[model samples]
Target: MDTQQNTALTRALAEVPGPLPARGVIHIVIPHTDRFTVVGNHLAQHPGLSTTAVGFAVRIQSLPQGTEIGVKALAARFPEGEKLIAAALRELEAIGYLQRARTRLPDGRIVTRTVFCNQPSALLRLPKAAPHQPATPQAPAPAPTPRPVPALPFPLQPIPELEPTLQPVQVLTTAPQSVPAPAPKPEPLPPLATTPECAPAPPPQQPAAPRFVPLVPPPTAPKLPPRPLPQPCELTPELHRAATALLADLRRHTPEFTLTEVDIQQLAPAVAAWLEREARPDTIRHVLTNDPPQPLRHPAKLLRHRLTVLLPPPLPGAHDLAVPVRRVTVTPFQTCDGCERAFRSSMPGRCRDCRTDHAQAAA
Candidate 1:
């Protein structure tokens, strides 16, 4: 049938209010069969089945077989509309009330076939199996006899005899004997020899002539002066222009403040530092003017402070001018006279080992 005919049939079946149905009403017949009651009860009691889904199921059942039920048509009939109708259709498909399958046509095109089953048995019934050859019947096994559980043994008896009482035994008491200490032995006095007066006179002869030793001073190392700090680089013309523009913009934003040449020079280094860090002039201007917690009385000072705080550290110089290089004299290694080992020393004659040995020998 054509679209117009189908629409007319649907409208006739619906019996919608208009000029036609004022006195009499048209009705769509829904079968009162066991299958219908089972399906309806199943859908009504289903926890997952929504009201819209139940309505859709009822409408689907009321409609004649082979009637094209599009989502749009079902949505127009149902209060929940298209999304709900689509969901309802999916629910029905999931629970076996409705089923859809894709079939390839002769023209190499695919089409979907949807089947609606009102009766639960139609969808739930199992297929019949193939017939098997008859076999001889076997005798049933004999029933097993239930054995009674054994009774537990009588409660354990208490011991008849009591333990013997412990008795105290008498212990003898004796006085401890004191031991006597040994006496100390007396020390003997050393014998004195007589001195001869003739031998004492020879000892007074010349306490040898006093010898003079030269004093040696300790070696001192030369001290190096501290390094000087590197000077900041000069600002280029581009940097100067950027700084001037930034200041002019800031002045415009804060009309109460004035930027002088001295202020500009003082702040130029900060601006140059920011520029070196790859921050654009516009970005710096935005940061300075966009949000000020309080009124900026000294715009130049604030800008300088911000630039200084945010500025990246300076790059390393190719050649550091502050640190001066000094010539260092290296002593040649000489073999020690005592240990026969090579060692570097400031003194030319002997190594430290040999010198320590000679000093010990003299001592």
Candidate 2:
């Protein structure tokens, strides 16, 4: 648990005698000769480790009392499994952590505890030292600081003398300022239709010029005319017919009614009429559906359920009763959205007419 202990374990592993490891997929087997058990681990869990987490698990195996410890606890404590138990288990199993044959319960039955891994736990391996290297150095201790002396208990330090101040004076005088004239301004004009015309104004006297110039128009392409916007109440023949059919069905169902609300019975035709009359659609939220907003299926995936006899429950009283009776097994049925009733298969995902009706309504 302490740094020194961890260091000692690392040194012990490093100092142990061992053969040189081969490059890539190194398979190591540490003999369980007793004092320290060998641990083997996946290279991945201990990326730079010479020994693996499985190797550590094997080392723990030498403890006589905890030999039958759960794979889960062992997986947690060991180096290889510490980082990733699932990945460690996979590698260990591949490397042969399991010796006992593994078995399974029938479908719907609980799994048992006794497991010899189909995969091995990464075994404990001896840590390796560099061949012929000097011993590792120990860290030195830090030195302590000395205490400071106390200041004089009571006498106040002597105060210093102060310096002189200067006198003030004032004098008088007066004056005022004038602003420059602004340039001549142009008179504002009123709107062409509202204001009356003035008698043609005389041209202002001009400064002398040497020459006069002629004016000319710049080049440009002809402009295209703008298109007119469409108005509401433009309906296609098909949309009108659908709306008509829907309204007729409503008339048959109720004689006296105001068409203010929209449901499946009301919304479909009303939405159609709104679309036909106006270019824009009425809000989709107006159609009231309690259906979930997400896709009903995990896109493109199919259900693959296994039906097995082991999953069945026993007949009540028959197991202890003398009289013989047949046992029946029951599974809940899936349902159809269109009819709010149970059915054997829901393959189409929605009720049969849902596809056609939804498309038309959405459009």
Local distance difference test, each candidate: 0.60, 0.39
Structural similarity to truth (TM-score) of each candidate: 0.26, 0.18
Summarize candidate 2's per-residue lDDT along 112-144 as a digit string, tens digits: 443333123222232333223222222133323
Q: What C-alpha lDDT, on a 0 to 100 scale, does residue 236 get in candidate 1?
A: 83
Cα displacement (Å) at residue 126, model 2: 28
Quantify how close model 1 is to the true structure by its C-alpha RMSD in Å.
Answer: 39.7
- Per-model clash counts, in order, read 0, 28
**Evaluated with TM-score, which candidate comes out highest?**
1
Residues 222-295, model 1: lDDT tens digits: 66553332123667887778766677666676664468888877676567666766667777777656665466
Q: List ranges where model 1 is wrong by over 4 Å.
A: 1-38, 76-80, 119-127, 132-363
Count steric clashes of candidate 1.
0
RMSD (CA, Å), each prediction: 39.7, 41.4
